[model samples]
Target: MTDSDVTISMFERIGGSATIDRLVDRFYDRMDTLPEAKMIRAMHADDLGLIRDVLKRYLTEWTGGPRLYTPEKGHPRLRQRHFGFAIGDAERDAWLLCMRGAMEETVTDGAARQDLNKAISGLADWMRNRT
Candidate 1:
């Protein structure tokens, strides 16, 4: 196929497993330490290990690398799963703050980073359950 005919998944564009891992790690690191993320951080377990792995797999699958998430977790009904949390605009912003910082630190490609940021920002917005 010609170069223009080739379609690269966002996963590949962002450097696959390694980048996803770093992104998730950085995201949680920010949540674990940032003052602004305190409310949302409180919703998570003190031990971030399990969620970290889950995010890695979810991001991997979401970005089109491999079916690392759904094969085990089924379709990511992310909003439904998060319904118990009191997610509001502030919570969404806090999440975006962490995710944006993580994307900046981990994702090297500018275009890919921007795309991921937009998509993830949408997701964070979507997760809001409160007005």
Candidate 2:
């Protein structure tokens, strides 16, 4: 099979919206409880409900599932949106730690899990604003 024919979207591999929701929920759960994630977690409001909804939408779109995010929020402009935060190596690593844990718990396919980790790690690295 050609690359186009063989390759499935990360969303499909991740079992679509329901699984994505579970992953996002678990990610925040880890962030809430993990001491390593405290700095990143402090960046959010006490209630994770709203952020979880936003993440579900964003991840859905990001993983090539649907366009739920932009219709409501316009451009993601992720870096601009995150400019207020000081995301150094520590914060990025902590964020990745929670995400890696979430993906491990939610995603079953090995290749899909690895691909997701690479993509997420790249994004997290990009989100870093400090030296």
Candidate 3:
């Protein structure tokens, strides 16, 4: 098999759009309910609808599924967009708690889950703008 044939995108391995939606929903749900997520959840608006959709699209595209986020929103520029938020270690850890919980509930495959966790952990850590 060629590289293209052997290489499967995390998006595909994670079950494409349907699973992405589920993961996003679970992530937000965890954030909404978990005490560990209170700090990060407070940074979000009262209504999570918009961010939920945006994240679904972003994760879809980020995992090599489709170009759903960039065409409308332009570059992700994640850190720049998040600059207004004071994301210290506590905030990052809080965010990761929600995300990791979501991943545990959604991504069944062990390798895919680990890969996603590492990538998301890196992203959450990068969002930290404070000491």
Candidate 4:
């Protein structure tokens, strides 16, 4: 089948697990170092190891890759899980800042990066729990 006839998943388009690993690592690195991300960074645990693993699995499944997170974590219930944190517009912006930087660093496909950015931007917006 021609490329036009093929349905490519975001996972494959973005170069799969390797890219995902790099993306998540870069994302957390930004969160850990970027001054702009301080507010959201404060919401995370001091140790990022566990959350790093969780995010990798979640992003893998969310991007239409193999099922890794759901089987272990059940439904993402992302908003519910994050309810303990105070996610506002500023928080979302900080998150997007880190994520966008990570995407730029790891997701090589331009179109895939843009699409993932849009989808993730929406998720970040929806996560806001404050004004």
**Whose TM-score is greatest here?**
1
Error of 3 at 70 (Å): 0.2
Show the lowest summed lDDT stretch of 10 residues, model 4. Answer: 36-45
Clashes of each: 0, 0, 0, 0
Model 4 lDDT per residue over 7-45, tens place: 999999999999999999999999999999999888889
lDDT of 2 by residue, 10-101 (tens): 99998999989999999999999999999999999999999999999999999999999999999999999999999999999999999999
Model 1 has a clash total of 0
lDDT of 3: 0.93
How close to the true structure is residue 60 of candidate 1, measured as C-alpha lDDT?
94
Q: Using TM-score as the measure, name the better of candidate 2 and candidate 4.
A: 4
Off by over 4 Å in 2: 1-6
Per-model TM-score, in order, reads 0.97, 0.95, 0.95, 0.96
> Model 1 residue 90 lDDT?
96
Q: What is the lDDT of residue 71 in candidate 3?
A: 100
Q: For candidate 3, lDDT tens digit of each residue in 1-131?
A: 67777888999988899989999999999999999889889999999999999999999999999999999999999999999999999999988988888999999889999998999998888888999
Worst 10 residues of 3 by lDDT: 1-10
Question: In terms of TM-score, which candidate is stronger, 3 or 4?
Answer: 4
Which lDDT value does model 2 have at 81?
98
